[model samples]
Target: MLKMKPVTRQKVNIVIDILMFVVMAALAVIGFLIRYTLISGEARWEKFGSNIEMTLFGLDRHQWGFIHLVLGVMLAVLLVLHIVFHWKQIICLFRRLTPLRPQRYALVSAITVVSLLILISPFFLKVELGESIRGQGERGGRNVSRTSGAYLPSESEDRTPLSSEVLNELPQTQAIHQNQNRRHGEARMLEIKGYHTIGTLAKNYNVSAAKLKNTLNIPSDVSSNERLGRIRRIYGFSMREVEECILALQHSTGDQTQHNNSQ
Candidate 1:
């Protein structure tokens, strides 16, 4: 066996910088989609999608808080890295600034200072711009509250509530019910016979080993290598009961597979 050489700090820094760029870009795109499509009602999805929309576009008071926080931290890290990378250049620039025209230097400094303040303010400021936007929308004609994203309404507008019966009736409850049904079906379908390992059980059920353990709440006293007796003790399931449950699951799975095949 050969030992691999450790990765260099420069490589790690580059990777981190690249990742930062990717995350920032993704955040920007998500923000834009939430703002333009979701807010404007040009495109629609489920309620959670709409909630996500609210979160991304800063419609919800609590939304964008984490985003802002994460971005602020990333910006700080980036700033530090940038300064570290270009320390000599930055020092030279500052030194040369005195020789430049006073008005030009003042303007540059002002812009730089303002930009830095904005980058840092979100970390400290508790101001909720989302609430302000929502309030404005409520006062205005556009019914922004119904959707997930904040809507900008005109000043000279009626505060009449728009009909949100459609949006309010998002099928989240139905989707949740279906998901629960599916999980129950899956749990029922999972079977353990004579001697089976958790890993094998998980593989048969097309689920992760961790998920199987979590679903069953397997006791810590039951070692991974323990026999069926431990399972019976932990779950209070007799051999007959276990067999019946397995049969029920097999039937259900067969029916589902048939239905899917037919479809």
Candidate 2:
């Protein structure tokens, strides 16, 4: 029988810590990217060459809510592990603080307390948070509408017409054209109202935010209203009635567009 070398518990613990740290770091980065992309309305590529759509479980806004819930649980678990591994250091730092250094202690305590409040506020307040130190709802240009689709404009006056020349200039225009060819060479224009954020759009469409973006060939990072404009330009559903017609066709026959013999 071959003798097996015993692995020290400390070494195992170290390995676990290293692995956990790597995972935690990755999760943090992913979470940050997701929030940033959603808030800023954009996308990023991961090391594995996957597109993280600022979405949950790779789904759209509604789907992302479920995904966010699951990810949040995983984040809590990782956070616990991080605390467990660093408890000794944390305790030591606390112990080192003394009344003699009242200012130092007060400063550290204030910072810690503020940080804690910032971290947990989103959960309690029912608002999304971001990595930026600025408080939630303070970010400029954030307009959330409950009734509009994900890409609808926040204000009626802010709405802009889709421009084909602008579309032709995009870096992904060639790829879009190729994809467009598969459906039809023609593009439709549409203007939609209701739902100002992707999350709202996902809920209204009964699809994931990611799917809507993918289906419309809109980048995850684009602003919500801009994305809607792109879809409108691509599909020629410039009006609500036309959009309704397209949707009706999709529901009635699973056909996005088909020629009518009468026409």
Candidate 3:
């Protein structure tokens, strides 16, 4: 068997330590980038405008998330290697901490079991849904429904225009494009969220509310004012499917426009 020299082993340990540190730092930085800078679409719209698209280094949040995941995998692998390399030292330390043979083995087994449970906990964790999308009511975004806590918008407020307050809150660049409402002559896609109501989506995306309901298979009895998230919970449909349907509707609209121009 090929055995590493003492010097070679020391150098390998140093390399491993350095790589682990670098990977950990990178992981933290990317995690912050995803959480704050490249925030969720819903957050972006609330902070900026629905028209605004946030990106860092030309990569969207999802792309950054992929890189973040890769970094996490690398960190986990490096951690395993680090533990393997220092296994003898670990055993010695445990022996000093718990001198009894049976106790030492029990301590080690308990720690190993705890570490594994912690690692796998995320997969088994339950995800919770939040309140459905509510409309901006005339009473200053207050007065939610008694049953659902959702603000029922009147016909005039149903297609609520971007309020001046919201406009003022936008960044200077976003403020400039607020009125233009054009994205490189292409239709913009809004990020679908549970809080979004069918009416709000239809009005914002320039699709008919009836068509939107039909596409999503939301029954006529289900109010358009009800939040998409609530509807999904009741009907059992993925948000991805909703987004795809919206995109398809936009594409069909664009195709019709092109056909008309060609005639």
Candidate 4:
């Protein structure tokens, strides 16, 4: 093979810096899309309440998170290489900023602390804002429970959260959770084996969809294709209780129809 052009140290550093810029820029764009597009509902698919299964760039958010981590490691390595290339200039700049003296150590320490605080400020800001909006805020750590969908469990029903053993014992209950990763628009509520969405169940039982949404505390904007088991889990209600409620209304409707027909 013909000998290629001789590589130089300066050229290598320049190439690494360029690659770093590209990686950082790409990460910035992806981070913005993940934080804003996903939260702002501009993403192609609706998120399932903190579930990371929504798609972007042909990959789910969980997959994207892994990619982001790998890119982050690459960026860090490039940064270290850049520092190695510029070690002399960095030493000179540090000397110019502050001489290595015992009296100057406090000033350097203060600068480092302040710089770190500034770099991490956005995270603290988000936490404060979240607490103000939806967390246990100025109420002295007291959290106000949401007012709507406050279904009190009857004496015969259990309001306590399910134990893992009890949950495992419930037949078919694990099936919905196992298949929770079904893609958007691929959820086939009516055809899914032994699983049903609130809308489909309501329609079959001749009950109002709005009633189902209200009684189950499901969000109104939730798609009709969401499985009933998923909604029950989200709303912290017993699946058996909801199913019984639906069956009761269905039987009552049938009885009324037969009596009216006889009259």
Candidate 4: tens digits of C-alpha lDDT, residues 1-263: 99898899899999999999999998988788677654432122122321123577687665666778889989989998998999999878877777767646777788789979986896787533221111111221111122321122333334453333443354332422332222111211111112577777777656667656654556788887887556655776544335434433433344445557877
Model 3 worst lDDT run, 10 consecutive residues: 135-144
State the lDDT of candidate 3 residue by residue for 106-133, as single tens digits: 9879989999999999999999964333
User: Each model's TM-score, in the order given?
Assistant: 0.31, 0.32, 0.48, 0.44
State each model's CA lDDT, in order: 0.45, 0.43, 0.63, 0.53
Candidate 2 clashes: the total is: 21
Let me know the TM-score candidate 3 reaches against the reference structure: 0.48
What is the Å distance of residue 101 in model 1 from its true position?
Answer: 14
Candidate that would win on TM-score: 3
TM-score of 1: 0.31
Candidates arranged by TM-score, highest first: 3, 4, 2, 1
- Residue ranges of candidate 3 with Cα displaced over 4 Å: 1-7, 133-263
Which model, 2 or 4, shows the larger TM-score? Answer: 4
RMSD of 3: 17.6
lDDT (tens digit, per residue) of candidate 2 on 153-262: 33433455223344334433343333221222112222234223445555555445554554455567755544344445554432222232323222222211122332
- In terms of lDDT, model 3 sits at 0.63
Which candidate has the highest lDDT of all?
3
Q: What clash count goes with each model?
A: 0, 21, 1, 0
Q: Give, for candidate 2, the lowest lDDT window spanning 10 residues.
A: 41-50
